[model samples]
Target: MKKVLLAVFVAGGLAFSADGAAIFKSKGCASCHQPTADTVGPSLKKIAQAYAGKKADLIKFLKGQGKAIVDPAKEAIMRPQLTMTKNLPQEQLEALADYILKYK
Candidate 1:
């Protein structure tokens, strides 16, 4: 019984961890920000590079607390998108940040 419960817990955690990319897509982030090439927004690689070694800052930015560092000139375009992310639960926010940072 204990092993079964442990397996269930681990599987749940894995599922949650894997939701980052899904959330990014479902939230329409991929509309502008592609994995490698810049479009309306900077590519994920650019964001990941800008945010490298700053996971907490990345999370804060997603939460609408931190300022944009990847492309301050285009912040106006990205600012409104925060509304979609600002209220996410911490776990989801962390997952999103992890997903973005994975490009680095």
Candidate 2:
């Protein structure tokens, strides 16, 4: 039983670790933000650059607690989208930030 429980726990962590990309897609972030090109919004690469070494700020931004720094002029366009990210659990938020940061 203990082995089964340990395996389950480990599996869950693995799944959670991969959820960032899935969550980004499921949350419809791909529509505006491309991987490396600027479309409706800045590319993930641009975002990663802006938030490099600032994962906490990135998470805060996603939570709607931090202002847009990469493209502040376009922030209004992204305000409505915050509702999708603002309430994510901390772990999920961290994962999302990690995924975005990896583009750097």
Candidate 3:
């Protein structure tokens, strides 16, 4: 039983997905940020493409410090979204950035 419990605990940690993806979905980012197609906002693929190799800049945006590099036209709509995520702790912000960068 001890061994079985250990296995289950290990599996739980392994089963956990990236924190950024969780934050994205919980914060309603996925509603507008699709994987490939544009919706209310640019898709994740587009954001990944535009911010390629610029993960720091992406995190900055999440922190409400960076400009809209992917879609300035829709920046107004996205600006409010920042309030939902900007105050997230640094670890969560990093995770969120990691999740977004994974789209590439």
Q: Evaluated with lDDT, which candidate comes out highest? A: 2
- C-alpha TM-scores of all predictions: 0.87, 0.88, 0.83
Query: What is candidate 2's CA lDDT for residue 21?
Result: 94
- What lDDT does model 2 reach? 0.94
Clashing residue pairs, backbone N/CA/C < 3 A, model 2: none
Tens digit of per-residue lDDT, candidate 1, span 32-92: 9999999999999999999999999999999999999989999999999999999999888
Query: Can you list the residue pairs that collide in candidate 3?
Result: none
Query: Model 1: runs farther than 4 Å from truth?
Result: 1-18
In model 1, residue pairs whose N, Cα or C atoms come closer than 3 Å (at least 3 residues apart or on different chains), thus clashing, are none
lDDT for position 25 in model 3: 87
Model 2 over residues 1-104: C-alpha lDDT tens digits? 99999999999987766589999999999999999999999999999999999999999999999999999999999999999999988989988999999999
Backbone clashes under 3 angstroms, per model: 0, 0, 0
Candidate 1 similarity to native, TM-score: 0.87
Task: Give the C-alpha miss distance for residue 57 in model 1, angstroms.
Answer: 0.4
Per-residue error for 33 in candidate 3, Å, reads 0.8
Q: For candidate 3, write residues 1-104 as lDDT tens digits.
A: 99999999887764454367778889989998999898899888888888888988988999899999787987999998899988888878888888887887
